[model samples]
Target: MNQQWRLDDGQQTLVLAARSGRLPECVYWGAPLPVTEDLVALHAAYALDVTGGMLDENPDLSLCPQSARSFPGQPGLVLRCTDEIRMLYGLCFVDAQQNGPDLRLSYRDAAAGIDLTFSFTTDPQTHVITCQTTLNTDRPVQVDWLAAPVLPAPQLSDEMIDVSGRWCGEFQLIRTPWSAGLRMREARTGRSGHEHFPGLIVPNRGTTNCQGEAYAFHYGWSGGHRMLAEELPDGRRQVQFGHATNTQAAGTQFQTAPLYITYSNTGLNGCAVAFQRHVRDRIVTDAHPVRPVHYNCWEAVYFDHKLPELQDIATRAAALGAERFVLDDGWFGLRDDDTSSLGDWTVDARKYPHGLTPLIDHIHSLGMSFGLWFEPEMVNESSALYRAHPDWVLGPMDQIRGRQQLVLNMASADVRDYLYDRIAAILSAYDIGYIKWDHNRLLPAPDAAQTHGTYALLDRLRADFPQVEIETCASGGGRIDFGILKHTQRVWLSDSNDALERLRIQHDAALFLPASVTGSHVGPRHCHTSGRTIDISMRAWVAAQRHMGFEMDPRELTDHEAKVLTDVTAWWKANRDWMMRADILRLDSADPAVIAEQQLAQCGSRFVVFAGKAATSAQIQPRPMRLTGLDPAATYCINVINRDHTPGLSRGNPALKSGPLTLSGAYLMHHGVTLPWHFPETMWVLEGTRK
Candidate 1:
């Protein structure tokens, strides 16, 4: 029997080895190893030496660490029989198969009647390696934990960056230096909580946005998840990701969500590019190749959905170049506010006496496609559906509610069928092309079944209405992940339309998400969530940076604001073709006050830079912002596209502010761009065309 195997894409390689039929362990994972290298010798060298206070020999630390084997740190599996006999081990490898760039290995615990399988596949294009594990038993078992195949972290790393955020502020990066103990993060809010996003990045000691080495991992699960970054007392490190402990109920079989990992040779942006490409080009299917400009009326109308008012909003949104108008949250039942009539999916007669047809038709007549919002997985106790089937609510009968609503029992076949029927009926009756599928509240508890059932429903919907697009929004940005994104086309980045706050959130989120699926909107003049007003030009340009949209009431815009918005919308439309396909690269800024990014076209012919002055710089002069991912030998023409936004502060002329300058890409990337000084909350937009 073969004792060693390995899989390699062009950029990276993963080598696994096993002895005496024990479960295989990954001995090497990083930049590509030579094809002719000796796997056996490499595996031997990778083994750690047992020292004083440790066992006579080192434990394998196999893909599934075993408790019975006396492995230190967190064991990969936690199980029980009936109510006792918690320990189960002695698994033997039973099968192995290597095909192309994919590998599958199987193992079994005979006495326990348990079969475990680990699978891996590397995408040659995006260079992302996806891994998953499955556990099946002949009889019922209570499994508290089952991690995806564990991988070792580099010892040279000094710190780790994990994602953390809240309601209005999502995708904030927190960095913690490496230590000798374990670092654990668990999202137990049922939905992937706004507080803990399932991602981590470990950079080499001297890594930056454009240099050195980096490794990234994203647990692509929408339900609760737990991440373990542990450095054992022996100095060995490993990363484990799985559903939050005990999220699974007793079952005969269980499997984990796919764990996506990518190693970057060119610093953090390389990881960013890999994830961004894999998500947009590989995961999302049939996304209208040309992403339409969005106009959601949630902030504009809330629950006051009057026919004339909606018609007016639609006309205004269209005039400002919105191609898809999504009538948000208040068009159904008695949903006058967030609290009531959530489960009722019917069009409200009070708001639209003749039904949604009038408003939808008005939107369609204005040359924009119409979209409706639905919270299919939530129910108000005051709703007719909830009253009729109280048993359909998840958790205990006395469980607390969120946003005045209880979660629907998505695990129940009856619940899924009812939701599909209601949602499908609406699709058949209307010429709708999009659905803003909302999940405004967290579940009473974490249950993997709920996420699976939701996926099942989405799959059914996608098959039935292949052309209809769906946006997964959970209280703004709570449910954004690769798992949910597999079913939906777009993600509502955050509820806060405050440009200053958005500039930071969007910049950090660009580490994983691409510009095409991230929805950024221009909020009202007085930002509802943040309460700090931002300039119309600032709001418009920020929205234009991603999947452009407008969620504000167009009627409230002053003549100057309206013109500025219209011009920015036109600019977004002109660039959407290539911009949607661009790779968003976070630039290394010399000044911390300026948060910046460069969206480079896929063809490498052009790029645009958004340098947002988030706060007042302590230094009076702006610092040079270095760009990445450009050919050093190429020459390019650079122009400050938003030069008109320059506020007169008696500023001396900065070369970029005066006119376009033709410079070599090497000079642009190394010497960097110098923009005129700007007040806080302002942004400088630069366009570059390779000559």
Candidate 2:
């Protein structure tokens, strides 16, 4: 006899409960309670009693955990049918609604005819919360697993950071610990797999990344996901994400990807500024609201194409400021590398016999903007669209071909209408705008309809090129998520262009990416995948920390590496429109060879720290570099914006290289920012403001 529900936005609060009307549970998520709290005495004080061999009825770890009620763990629905195995017992509750800030809910089972629902919403300007689940059955069945609406793990989290990596090391933050049963993590190599990167975070237990308490999830599916967390043997804990248990195929509606949770009491950079402002203001879209300065030419002339050597490397990447160029992977078919012309999206004409319109009119006469590189779910059986569709190739035909290509069934609608008429005839024949879109390999199986046919061909080329902008390269950071950032706009986070390992994979992928959809590049002072030489000022301030670019070979730099890559690409084009709407944070480093961050500014009146030492510091002059979110009674005016990267082994006088230091944001976040004796791949760069 219970029933509760809650949902608020300003920072957090979720609630949810159920008892007699069964299946519901997320009993009290954190922070913000009291618009008159007392959700049925907070679900009977979030129940938990019957000890000694448990089960005197404590199974409501509900929200779908049911195996006819003796609930244990990992059972959020797992149906079956082709001759037995189904157990969705007594799933009660049949309605609850709201629909504005969303809140749905509805359950059924009706003697296993199924039904389930659950929606949830919340954003209040990116505090982020989104959940989902759906089932609907009646007859056909198979869904071997469903979940995406389980939530409830914080037993003061002893550890959980998840998000592993491979292929030039994508993201990489693992952590683990919180024991006593099931920790699971799956991906099944089907895009979103440079070894599982769907995302999770936990924290709580003296959390850090500048404060305490955390909790973050993110399974926005791009095929084959599985997460879990668990604990319960009565200690109660749960997590669960879905889509990878059976890869579903005999069904009557089944849904799950849209988890995206969030909750942070100012640490883990408040769930990294609410999943980077809900993915740069609500899940990317047709992009180009300023974020340019790029330049790709695949490590300069990879297949050795030469239209006057890419118009002299696009006039030295537009005299070092760039602003967009792209053209990676030998520009198409008969492609001289990565095993032949993938899916032949034309445009090669024997390496542009005057076709990519003279390199898109010399990169639009160097004012830039041109990008192009496609893989479009592979194919290359020596090309010409796998010799005219070898049965539209997907899964088996004697599988086993990743870089030699194959997977192009995108759940065929005649192969998404012949790869959307050959990628809309090269985005309607050139003057492209942008599109890196690569995927590189892995997936001889694990198809959630080939990620819904590559999100129906990137949502039909974003509704017929609403000003083209795509960018989600998989062989690098293997298909990053928020489910392909809802059809693309930057993320090629790593293919090891190694700037001291992209400054620790952009400092632990800023705990869930943000540097405006992170891409960062500036390779080739000998870093063709970690042959690590690094120094063009630590590779242009670690590619000016994200979204900035230049994948090596701007004629192999060196006029002092082309004036330090033209003064850090002119200070990332003069603070890239408020550092691409800042808030990266991550700083608490009393030197583990420092790998700082602190972008700030979203009306916190300007900031920027950087810090980066990356090796050699077990106590040796240079520490106090902390700073996060600011404003402890203001007064900043910092400076030290790269005191010419300082080295020559310390002739000490570290008032951060003498100059500008008004301090006090509680003395630079509890006395930090001293740093001066550099070496071991340095990278400082400060720049406060708010006096």
Candidate 3:
């Protein structure tokens, strides 16, 4: 069997140190130890479920981490670790049997070992799986796991990854891991700490362009979490999973593994690797459940709506029990809607009399949180800021177009300080809790030519404000990624508001992002983009299950629809905890139809099932629907709440029973029950023992 995957000559020739079952036995080094490696000296670790042949649970893994150590004048430098470490990597294909193939890797000190034992399918197709390590270990460990096999190429530029082409690069580090911090730092002039954590350190040819060849995702589980370092096709070297995006060099999706060691006494270090092999027009995160439902005024006001009108909407929304009231675009600058009022930070006097103070005060009075929208990175020809600082705009200084809108030079220190000041000033004026920071356009110059320092400005805001929650939005879903999620609390998933369109889009989004970080809203039936009227109940129910909000004019909702909205909001308030901490199980369907089910396990026993938009069926039998992360022996009371009408069933059936029924078969073959019916429904409260 060929274990080598996409290996080049350099990697093929790379020698792995030999390991014998019995090590050089010494007083300090032997087969076993009375004293385990200190957890403080570890970087990451993984537990393998050898009994179940899956990573079903890992409670015994360990790591040893210490302060970063760096030696000067070294290329491809490898750090010598005094502490021992262990990492476990496992994979169980959804289609494979419960006793199928599970791959586990244990890395200790500097040696790495792999344990591949499982039932390989008859078909020969390799599936790549990865986990990113969290970098915040108690002690520091320096390493880059996602080492993309370097191709014979020129230096990597923002352009090669700017569009659709293959990419290859390497990450090298020569330092004491504990001496450095979490983020990977890069240098344009010096070579020191260039390939540190979260930064792509590739073999350079002393030029700015690459040879158009690169490997994608390689990572390790570190800091009690998984981390991946890969140079994506979109000109962004994403570290971990936080800011995962393929947009036009606007920003990056940054992420690493979870932090917090599983057990207090294991000494091991591990990292994760991930790859999005398929090519898609855009890259988005998964649909997180229980995203705060929001109320924004963009389509309704468009810079013309009066403060009273805005106040009325916010008050009514609060009365209906909305979590947040977002004052959309036009609230800042002379601009309104996509054109006129950008870059200008002043609140329009005619529209907002007495500034935003009255509006914010009114929102606060209603016992709700207030969110204001701002697009500080864009400029209109008529705006005061653009006139005052023409050089601040990104386009050719002399270039002029009929519709003159300019991009702010976010790379410049002056621009960042100025924008930060404007944002801080307004936020201070009102006791604001959230900001819906919007960027309506892509980078006018794909290469990020602007002089306004993007990462620095953003990092400054996070460090400075600390309290404000920023929701990153770029024209809709263009800018969703991990890098932004680190500092911002929420992100608008996409501009495509159609519920039918959202099902697939959200499914794709959730693969990389947790449900808590995404913004999935329940908009009006008549979408602003598609001009189609969908059932409000269906939309609300689906959106409500995820981090949600409303986008339409509330006044337009019928009395009956309004009640549904109010009722659903109440339910969300009551049941938020279950949606937040529980592990999610999503069922798959292959019929080019819409059938989605999310099972949330609470307290590790009780579970909630949200089955949305399925085709009508007398009996809905999901294949191998084994519940995840449950205690096999503890019995649970299973309840099914049917939100839609299926022929033979009613809402909240107390007699439904299943698992504690052992999880046998492939993940797909795991224990799943048959529902009597389906379609635009939500069947929940299914519980059982993990037998």
Alpha carbon deviation, residue 176, candidate 2 (Å): 34
Question: Which tens-of-lDDT digit does each residue in 1-691 have in candidate 2?
Answer: 6788899998889989887888878889989887988789888887876867666778778777887777877788878885767654677888999766889988887777888898989988888888899888888888788888988888987988888879898778889888889989888888778688888899899888889989999888778888888897767788888889888788788888899899998888899889988988888866887798888878877888888888898988889888788888877777888787788888778778778898788789878878788888878888877777788888778877777777788888888888889988888977687888888888876878889888988888889887888888888888888888888877888888878888898788787778977888888888877686877888788888878888878876768888888888898888888888887888888778878887888899888888878888887788677787888898888888778667777798877698887878988888877867888787888888997
Clashing pairs in 2: 558-561, 624-673
For model 1 the TM-score comes to 0.98
Q: Show the colliding residue pairs in model 1.
A: none
Sort by TM-score, best first. 1, 3, 2
- RMSD, one per candidate, in order: 1.2, 17.4, 16.3
Where in model 3 is the C-alpha error above 4 Å? 1-292, 397-404, 448-452, 590-592, 614-632, 643-671, 680-691
Off by over 4 Å in 1: none
* Candidate closest to the true structure, highest TM-score: 1
How many clashing pairs per prediction, in order? 0, 2, 104
Supply candidate 3's per-residue lDDT for 2.
Answer: 9
Error of 3 at 598 (Å): 2.6
Model 3, global lDDT: 0.43
